[model samples]
Target: MRNTQQRKTEWLNIQWKGGVMTHPVQQDGSSCGVIVVLMAREIMKAFPNVPILQFGTSRKEMANERKMMALQILKASVFDEAENCSMCSLKKPTGSVHRFINWIQCDTCERWYHEKCLGMAKEDLEQARANTWSCILCS
Candidate 1:
């Protein structure tokens, strides 16, 4: 197993280059690799164990899948955090102790939610441990 930090770097170093990312870019290379690596670090920290599927034999397919996986990871992390927000209650009286979750997001699709409107439990939402949480729509 690769070190977590190095693993992240290696994954992000991959890029779409003339339909193949195996070769390093000789020009404008340093910036793109660094940017992607940093983005990967943020995404991996936010979402763990996101599936990366590549069915086609082409390198393009592999590259696309990797990009999609990274996007999904970021989406998962965003949704996981949004589900716990407690600002969604519209009918609650002002100065209420309970902070309603106003912006809940679907873990699969990245759809936003209004807690009360979406009929989700605050406790249940807050108790979610993984970024793979699914919303009612996705479920």
Candidate 2:
């Protein structure tokens, strides 16, 4: 199997035109997938006429676009519940120590919690891993 960096590089190689477009540099290691999806959405909105496989624009231009898109996201007033832990209601800041904690989401209630908060042992949690998991209350 490809290693993490190799897999990431392979993902970045997806073409937009003849030129390969670079993925935005994520501010942190966490939430990269979310950032990528958001970046793609912003790019699509900004360049509706541009073909997905065409990267006629410069990298610098795309970087600037990304910055602008980030600003737009920050300016929006809508809040996402996933920004906090469901049980404790603690904000999960990207750079905080909580970022390193193992958090699980309940598929039924769509709520998030630190694994320890749910009285889950690390081994038990690993053994029970599934595509969708429900918390004890939901289960």
Candidate 3:
């Protein structure tokens, strides 16, 4: 067994290095987050049996998984309803799965809008997560 000081040192080392992880790599870099989700689901579903690292998920399969997940989310969002973009009045954003989540809320009114609907540049709109933003109406 490790001593207290040795354990603490190990913990600090892991934290500094963002914690060690081993997982299957995505062919295309962009699908890492999605792949992680699929892997977690597979782990839960296939418990007792270790998750196969090579589930034969090609880029196309990953794309299909993402779409399926998005559709599932859209159907049953947030306990009941999906938030609609105030500008477009659409529940889902228009674009790829990545862009489907490009929503921002007014710090004042708390209404959500598609980032594109606000006509704001990506850098300009999503500057900082902590930064408070208001819609035109709120402003």
Error of 1 at 50 (Å): 61
Ordering by lDDT: 3, 2, 1
Cα RMSD of all models vs. native, in order, equals: 19.2, 18.6, 15.0
Model 2: which ten-residue window has the lowest total lDDT?
50-59
Q: Distance (Å) between predicted and true CA of 125, model 1?
A: 1.6
Q: What is the alpha-carbon lDDT of model 2 when measured against the actual structure?
A: 0.63
Of the two candidates 2 and 3, the one with more favorable TM-score, higher being better, is 3
Question: Where in model 2 is the C-alpha error above 4 Å?
Answer: 1-80, 92-99
Candidate lDDT scores, in order, read 0.51, 0.63, 0.72
Clashes of each: 9, 5, 0
Estimate candidate 3's alpha-carbon lDDT, on a 0 to 1 scale: 0.72
Each prediction's TM-score versus the true structure: 0.26, 0.34, 0.37
lDDT winner between candidates 1 and 3? 3
By TM-score, the best candidate is 3
lDDT at residue 131 of model 3 (Cα atoms): 95
Quantify how close model 2 is to the true structure by its C-alpha RMSD in Å: 18.6
